[model samples]
Target: MRPPAPRRTTALLAGLGLLLAGCTTAGDDAGPGESGLLTGPGITETTISLGALTDLTGPYAALSTSIINAQQLAVDEINADGGICGRSLQMVVRDHGYDVQQALGAYTEIAPSVAAMPQLLGSPMLAALLDDLAADQMLTFPQSWDSTLLGRPEIQVPGNTYDVDMINAVDYLLRSSLVAEGDAIGHVFFENEYGENALSGSTFAAEREGLTIVEQRVMPTDQDMSAQVTALREAGVTAVLFSAGPAQTASFVGVAAASGWEVPVIGSTPAYASQLLETAAAPALEGLFVMVSGAPAASSDIPGVRELVESYQSAYPGESIDGGVLSGYGVMEFLAEALRIACDQGDLSRAGIIAAHRTQGLVEGDLGMAMDFSDPNRPPSFDSYLLRPEVGADGGLVEIESASRAPAVDDYTFPTSG
Candidate 1:
């Protein structure tokens, strides 16, 4: 039998997993990398700084600011602990305003200070910089769940959907009465290039299970979708997969729920933010099934899950970490791990960071999985699980464990190629 993970190794892996999965707990209140005498228990160096660009002031404000704050808290914790190789942790933040031009400007200005640039948490913006980020050797912690870029641009993606979570949810639905064995799964996705890949992944997975796409409704990313939802209901779709952001998802799912449609709402990871369930309301979001790439459905049960949760709570008192915060924390934690490995390898080089990301295993961290970006064929989690939304006591969402789903990711052996 495999030996139990060593304690130190487990702690290390826990740290790595939290950073990668953005599991910034309320209790992780370490200040900055400590100084020789100006040290906190975890504090280490004085002033080491990395950069992050976020949608803090824009349309996605629902989760962006909280995410940045969580990332900052993680950095402060590492710095307090005498950060990687004695360098203090500092996070230089840039607000993207959820706009592409602003993101480009922020990206251009902060390109040189840090070892690598973590991408903003938006699809349109990330897509705008795929080639530029790769060209600059700027590695990123996965944010957008779009996986189409995996084989096309060679950009880094750690928690993407096709290879991460949604496929299995679609597979499970296929085996259920939701869809007839030979029937195709219908989809109502945003009609943008970014949302296309999500729909494609569902199609690929559905086909793998002998299901087809019988009716697909493509709508604009930000349009009012009463018509689209109506159309899907009229199509007589048994089940549907939504590939848009929170707003459109709420619109479609809410309408479907109100119209007495019994279709199980399937969603991309982006639409799985815990806030969405509440904002979308019951009748609309009840029994909504969202597949995710990180953390178990009920994270509070995982070993350090509660710790991270409380850490976030303490750090940002009165703040709540809905589903999106988890993603934010996961990505930040992973980036820290890569940075730690980069320092361990002597120099803070991107190549060294990438190497560390590949060689490391669970080490007993939150995501409870290993991440390997050493190959190009796969840029995201080679596997993922499903998260069902169950109404909690306060009439809020509780990601339920209706099923444990993950795809048979057999392509890890595929070479990392563009």
Candidate 2:
């Protein structure tokens, strides 16, 4: 039997509508500021507009909606704190439905108007828009952590790349004695950049540990995991590494449980959704582990996380949230710091934003791992948090391990720009 979905109150939904409508402002015809600070697109004398290319009506809509709400909250808080550099922050949001074409169109429409984008979700969509982003010199913070997005002056990934995340997952399993050397583990992933990138990490870790990986590549549209599970079981895999969406994770784990395959399953951050706890797969998911960049928002002991939870609850009253809320809030805060730096340097142009980001030395905040944003050629951080699902937990997940970089990651070579 499945549990009921979390309660998303009507007031919460209405709040989201109001936030979107309020934040979506058109670019103004105003020019440079009176303070002698050079200004560019998205920045007027009174406001600084940022773009949010997100997904609200697609496979990851639940997560994206939480992210958007958190972002709105961050904007509200920043604006209330006297704004940045004498200008209020305004977010121009556009939902792309996780479609590449739609994302490109949205970027095209907003790129000329906004100074930068704080939230560009979807690996495939970001991959498609890379060239356009570079041409416009738009400073963007992608929600994805694909290695291919690294080393780009215009794009900044907030945490460990997908490959690094998978490597850490494998290390966690091996160290915890969940899997042994010379055993075979199954890897089920999408054929897209996100999945392929994760596969590289698993492949590297398997080779180093003398373990074998049985691969199962699936399309984004693939849902049922009976065939993949059957293949892995036949291959005698001792464990499973999953790098698909939440739906695939539930299906794989549910199917495995029904078939009596009790192997441990480790998945990337995107693979689990809190709402999955409501399904029949809930019991099966209790054994699943997820790798992420930061501690779960709902249960972290960090002071910032506590403040975020209090503020969110106070604002929305009865809305249920997930890790995306913390992620959204953290990424937006990172961008705000960069804007502060740019403002201090007397430049708020798009180029100025990128330059300011490169100067960020060590970033420590309430929502994520400590990262050094000083270099564009390397990942900001290699640490990952291991989490397990718990039904009564605030976000349906609890941190089993805090942020740590695996020893194997030290030897792994990150790919550089071509």
Candidate 3:
């Protein structure tokens, strides 16, 4: 049976609401940074520093390491090519060891010393430091996608943070699939706040589609998942929307397929990363569906795409390129644009960088989607695409097929970089 017309409107709202434009915390006027070119109060003789917090020792190490490499690649590339402004970028790295208090201590240490903060990565850790960063006036470049971080999930934000990831794969199911009231959709989410935010959207989206969700399974970051998979199978779920990373995602897919639980799987952007899937064994994730807010690996058609690819390969020899590389490139794109804007405006201030991003929308020549930080918007990305993760003859996520028609730039509205 066809979905009713009224349900279509609700689905659209769900999609828009999930886009997470300024949905988290209260919107702030993010001022610019201190530029060496400006001979003023904030300007200093030392190198302009951009620090980041890493879970270099914890369960999230693989992705965390990737995030750090990606961010650092941007930093190293910028520094090599005359750096951000005339001042070189000094990376102040800290390891959180998967501990929130450790992460906070690192944040506290970096807050006063650096011009900007670690576009902080990881779920609970980043959310844990949200209020401190806001109160201390540190610019952040976060790598986590947990929408609840905008409000409250597990690690309560001192205040509402903008939840950009309020939408994920579930949006597609509600709008495109045939889920009805009698059918139950099974969901599994990580215990972290980001995982909850990602999974909760699935629940709400399933309900909006007139579907009854019977089983909700939650797992800690380090727990084994054989039981969760078995439980979902017993529950008679017709489909699944998940909040897991590549590793757990792989485990679920492998077990689901082997156990004859053959439901089509759908997940947020994190599930789509090629490196993550590859790390988890490429063949294990074949035939899975994923939705994320960026284009596939850097395409050749995009300007500067080749340079980025070459730079990434050169930096990490023998390591296969992953989807996370685009993010590494984007951070630099923002940093460089901020520098250019600071130069043109004759000052490097936090507000200046915000003005640059808001005014001169820097079209991502390489990373696919342009980063947007508009006057009323702070969720820097919303360009999402859908794909099926099928293994090629080469044993990799060989061929990608985009489920959407919008180009990377057209997918999102960038702030004017005037």
User: All predictions: root-mean-square deviation over Cα?
Assistant: 8.1, 9.0, 10.2
Q: Please give the CA lDDT of all the candidate structures.
A: 0.57, 0.80, 0.52
Question: Which should have the higher TM-score, number 2 or number 3?
Answer: 2
lDDT (tens digit, per residue) of candidate 2 on 1-418: 0111111111112232222222212232333466667677888878999999999999989988888888889889888788889999999999999999999899888888899998999988988888888877788888887887877978998788889998998998899998999999999999988899999999999999999999999987999989999999999998899999889999999999898888788888888888999899999999655545444546777666777877877777777768888888878888888788678767677777777667676767656567778777788889888888888887888888888889999999877563
Candidate 1 C-alpha error for residue 367, in Å: 3.7
Worst 10 residues of 3 by lDDT: 1-10
User: What local lDDT does model 1 show for residue 45?
Assistant: 43
lDDT by residue (tens digit), candidate 3, 138-174: 4566666543343221121111121223233444554
After superposition, candidate 3 runs with Cα above 4 Å error: 1-43, 148-168, 174-182, 271-281, 289-293, 298-306, 351-365, 376-378, 390-418
Question: What local lDDT does model 1 show for residue 124?
Answer: 74
Residue runs of model 1 more than 4 Å from their true location after superposition:
1-46, 151-154, 215-223, 277-280, 288-293, 361-364, 391-399, 402-417
Ranking by TM-score: 2, 1, 3
Top-TM-score structure, candidate number: 2
Q: Pairing residues by index, what is the TM-score of model 2?
A: 0.91
